[model samples]
Target chain A: EAGVAQSPRYKIIEKRQSVAFWCNPISGHATLYWYQQILGQGPKLLIQFQNNGVVDDSQLPKDRFSAERLKGVDSTLKIQPAKLEDSAVYLCASSLEGGESAIYFGEGSWLTVV
Target chain B: AQSVAQPEDQVNVAEGNPLTVKCTYSVSGNPYLFWYVQYPNRGLQFLLKYITGDNLVKGSYGFEAEFNKSQTSFHLKKPSALVSDSALYFCAVRLYTGRRALTFGSGTRLQVQP
Candidate 1:
């Protein structure tokens, strides 16, 4: 089976610019997630979507970051007015409906904000 | 609140030797533990998870994790390490209730020398 897919494996933007990342999850997956992985740290969940409905987004920066899963199959994560701190890899993952299922991730989109 | 901690920043092991990576977690309710591996410039790959049942869970690439409820720890282990096994490992946790997303640890770098 095909794994989760993401676009623009690498991206670079200047501070104050806007950037967007896209994700297409595995077929029949019911849960999608967006995570940010800064250097020297683990992946941090930015948002989660359960069938197009948000399940959790408490750690997301509302002022600069936004995410949406339209039709529950594809997702997009956007960061407006990017800062140097936003330079990190954006990873997208998907899993089956239940919490017991394992999550598979895409290759990720590496963003470097200068 | 749920959180995970990887005590070691890096672990070095010679090829064919046994290796261990330590992890601890904090959660209000029952904890769901997970292990993921990531290569350079890549997203995380699911290694295994411990939701319930047996405390010892075997996962991909001959890796296993032992879950200790008393200590609130889940340490990843491998009997014989290979150079290809070198990567970044992350431990994650989530409560059984409330949130559906995971909180990841700071990640441990495994360096297997050939």
Candidate 2:
């Protein structure tokens, strides 16, 4: 079976510019998630989507970051007015409908803000 | 609130030797523990998880994790380490109270020397 897919394995943007990352989850997966991983740190949960509906986004920076899973199959995470601190890898993962299922992650999109 | 801690920043072991990565967690309710491996410039891959049942859970690539409820810890272990096993490992935990998000540790880098 194919794993989760993401686009633009690497990205570079200047501060104050906007960037977007895309994710296509595994087939038949019902839950999707976005995470941010800074250097030397574990991936932090940014948002979660359960069939196009948000399950959790408490850690997301609403002032600059936003994500959406349209039709519950694909997702897009956007960061507007990017800052140097936004330089990190953005990972996407998917799992089955139930909460206890194992999550599969994509290779991730690395962003470097200069 | 739930959180995870990986006490070690790095672990070094000779090939064919046993390796251990320590982790501890804090949560209000029953904890669901997980372990993931991340190669350089890649997203995390699920290693194993402990939702319930046995204290020992074996997972992909000859990896295993021991869940100690009394100590609130779940440490990843492998009997024989390989050079290919060198990577970054993360420990995560979530509550069983229907909250679907996971709290992750800073991560541990494992280095296996030949």
lDDT (tens digit, per residue) of candidate 2 on A1-114: 999999989999999999999999999998999999999988899999999999999999999999999898999999999999999999999988765777889999999999
Off by over 4 Å in 1: none
Query: How large is the interface RMSD of candidate 2?
Result: 1.2
Clash number for each model: 0, 0
lDDT of 1 at A91: 91
Backbone clash pairs for candidate 1 read none
Give the per-residue lDDT of model 1 (tens digit) for B15-69.
9999999999999989889999999878899999999999999999999999999
In candidate 1, what are the lDDT values of residues A11-108, reduced to their tens digit? Answer: 99999999999999999999999999899988889999999999889889999999998787999999999999999999999988776777889999
TM-scores of chain A across the candidates, in order, are: 0.98, 0.98
Model 2 residue B17 distance off true place after TM-score fit, in angstroms: 1.1
Question: What DockQ results for candidate 2?
Answer: 0.75
Whole-model Cα lDDT per candidate?
0.93, 0.93
